[model samples]
Target: MRINRLIYHEGKVTNPYSVAPTSHFFGSTSQSDPLFWFVYACGPLPHTRGYLLFGSTLLSGWPVSTVHRKEASRFVPSSVRFFSFHYLSSASSFLHPLKMEFKKPATVLNLANIRQALVRMEDTVVFSFIERSQFYESPSVYAPNKYKIPNFSGSFLDWLLLQNEKTHSLVRRYESPDETPFFPDQLEESFLPSLNYPPVLADYADEVNVNDEIRTVYIEKIVPQIAAKRGDQDENIGSTACADVDCLQALSRRVHFGKFVAEAKFQNEMAHYTNLIRNKDIKGIEEAITDSAVEAKILERLIAKGHAYGTDPTLRYSQNPQSKVQPEAIAKIYKEVVIPLTKKVEVEYLLRRLGDDDEAEAQDPQRKTQLMNRLLSNSLW
Candidate 1:
């Protein structure tokens, strides 16, 4: 049988023999003769018969088929069946659609870039801390049931953070390798599209979650130290909680980014790290990598950053202008906690990196070679 001529008007398909309306083309009407409405995007010429395989089941309008008028009705049934069979055969083939894959940039997380991130984070941390400090360490904020969040305990900060992460975790926040959530269990499944982040970091990047440690340090040490002089009344609980959470997230980002630094360092000096790691020399590893001068400089920078951010520049010739924010305390936090924790992460990652390299070599020689090549090419080492 041949489909001689076909015409499309609105939702109707008319060939030389018969007119097929939308009602007849759809539902139970077409069930008995389902192949009757094969609609191809391209005009059906005799040569490109293969194109007809992609035809839709829906009734579509074409100007008209080219076949002769007398033989149209006789050819329609066989032509439709052939089209259906072609479609099924093409669909079952092993050939797949081309998928786009994004590789993470290898040079994205060197020491310079990581330090720049730290510098940027300083502004965020200071601004957030300043905003939270407006509430002046209100005791009621830490009181239970202050904020009614489901399946939560502890302070208003905790509840607020819990709910915020629950929503944001489904978006871009959780997927970012740099962010570590305070409440992992509270995070909802990500409803957002995948960003296809590059896995330039070591495998140990997934193993660490410093959120709990950060939260504890902030609450027990950083807050009291900063707010030691804050003697104010309980006011503006909501703003305070929000600011607190923002500061917490900023801090988390800063601390967790240690993974990137560690990755960069290990990639650069794999041999040096391998020697220390093989010998199980944690102290030697620390000594080899740690620059006391650099650490001292970082502490000084923090102190300077605190003073610059905390003090009002507008006040001219002010006598003994007491700053609410403590610069020395910030310096101390970095000097003691933040710097040490980052180095600790470096050591931890190096320890695991040796094993990961060995495993990769054992399992996939090509992959190990590629990784070795990447490490060798990195001039930053």
Candidate 2:
């Protein structure tokens, strides 16, 4: 296999016949002319390590180094295969579209990826909470107001949520299987084209939305984690309402992250989950996801994030003179509300594992009882 010699001059590639005019190489990143790209394939001596000679001068930027077989394939584009025989000969097996298909690397939904997302989310949650902490408690935001607007009622938060529905409706953030808005019924239909959220986990959508449970627990249990410190001041209705909306949205995202965790766990231990679901064993499901070791690490990470974000040296002499957010409180929330609720969601979702088509088996009380008894007898629990 042979390709026309590529004459490189003044950072542009030209053919020997001068039939094709000089053109910049696609994605040529170097600033200067005579840029050197370590020749992987596409030259007289393909296997030997050498620089692509640009008019008898060895280009400065390209380093002469041994190229791995795997990396050599990446240097040439499929579109230019006929033009470069060196790449064509090596990658000829890939020429037949029917024989083999090229695809982007798969994004495996696993614990490591989920944990990385959770780590990034910690920053979002902590920062949102910090912003919200500046305002004092205003219970009025959750209550019905006597004054009513054209299409809005309830407190200030209501109007704000309505405004979001009107403006961001086009973006369709709610359509994302990952996102669960606090005001689901109130959300306007999205006008924009829908985009898939982690199409790889499409099956997990039925289990992902634990927003209602998260909102309930957050308002009842997790609010004290931050509100207790910030709520001591006199109420500022506007600020408080804004803060409440921000806090709830951020908190919801953090808690619902359990879906990712659950998906990862299920993928890792499919057999274990299948057995538990078959036996209708809730306790087994809980135990499978519960790892005291991992939970401890998560709690410590959240606490550190809180301290890092909460304490500002410039505010040391302020009248408050205290961290608006407490590390211990953050740690406690994860230990008690966040993790427990997440595990609960996983168990609940697993309980309904049999889809609508399996209604008969899923709904049969007698079948469930027998399975439970059989599992108990076997000491599988």
Candidate 3:
């Protein structure tokens, strides 16, 4: 991966050899004395500890005029020492195609290695001692209190007594601490917010139980506000029709089953959707149409708020096919409004169904009881 660039004197001199005989040879010789300069960049090195030498110097007749004494004399007078001569004499000659080698020192763990070995040795010693003690055959070695018994029932009773003794000994060795005092004075009061709401009484509220009234109020007041906040936060999440109904149906089934779905399953669904879009499937196109409509609506809202258009030159044109509005027409309507309207309608219908289900569950206790019973039966059987 090394690249080398060579630069030399730019000007050219006429060669007396190629020119007419009238030209002076001395003038042409100036061109032959061109100084060659080279710049080299060697790509990433393994150890970054080596020295570089010019490989060209190893070639035969290199420093070309050095072999010719007459030509060399022109550059270097007889009194002057030739540096090239000294360099060639001292150069180490090696075999062609030198094989480069790198040596890395073997790694050794210090005190940690010794500590680990010692710990393992201690464990082995403890295990061996336990194993050796277990081999003792005399019953008196384990328990000296057992009385001599000859009858079959007496032997059974002796064995049971030995087991009970072992159990009691082990239990006495390891026991939990005494229970903490239960008095309020001994307890530290936590400053954390209380989850329980206080009772609210009214003439109309009297018909409903206090707990039920509180819960109903929470659902009516808190739940809708939470839902609205979530919807606002997720406003930018582009809505598109599910590319694979079968996959979506599978996901819906898993949601209904309350089973854990792996990340791979979700990624597979995303990949499937991407492939469908790449293949220009009708469903994918429909999804794109729906998303485009949503994007247009968002853009319209931004424009109505006196927001400046984005700086991107490509976005100067509305993405709609029917949009013929000029770039300067800031209050222009999107051309393909019908598709988004249709998608909005479809989404609104689904939302309404969900809302109706919530309302039905809240109003009808019988329905709730039946649903709970069905879920319980499904789980059990």
Q: lDDT tens string, model 2, 1-381?
A: 222223222222232222112232222223343434434434222433321321211323322222223333345444443355554333321211111011210222435545666677778777776776666554555556734657665656667766765556568777654566666666676666666443434264544567666656765676655664533344466676667667667766666656656655654565677678888888888888888987888888888788767878787667764666787887787788777876776676666655663345445556645643443332211
Which should have the higher lDDT, number 2 or number 3? 2
lDDT of 1 by residue, 104-175 (tens): 243454465566667778888777776666666656666777667677677787888888998898786877
lDDT for each candidate structure? 0.60, 0.54, 0.25
lDDT of 2 at 139: 53
State TM-scores per candidate. Answer: 0.64, 0.60, 0.13
Per lDDT, the best of the predicted structures is 1
Best by TM-score: 1
Better of 2 and 3 by TM-score: 2
lDDT value for candidate 1? 0.60
Q: Could you give candidate 3's per-residue lDDT for residues 1-381 as a string of tens digits? A: 121211111122233122112121211223233333121111111122211122111111112111122222332334332333333222211101111110100000111222233233323322222222222222221132343544323322233433433443344311111011111122333344332322111112111112222223322332232121322222221111111112122222212111011111212243443344346464553453244554455446434332222223455465642212222222221122212332332222222222344345445557645753443332220
Candidate 2: RMSD to truth:
14.7
Lowest lDDT sum, 10 consecutive residues, model 1, at 92-101
| lDDT computed for candidate 3 | 0.25
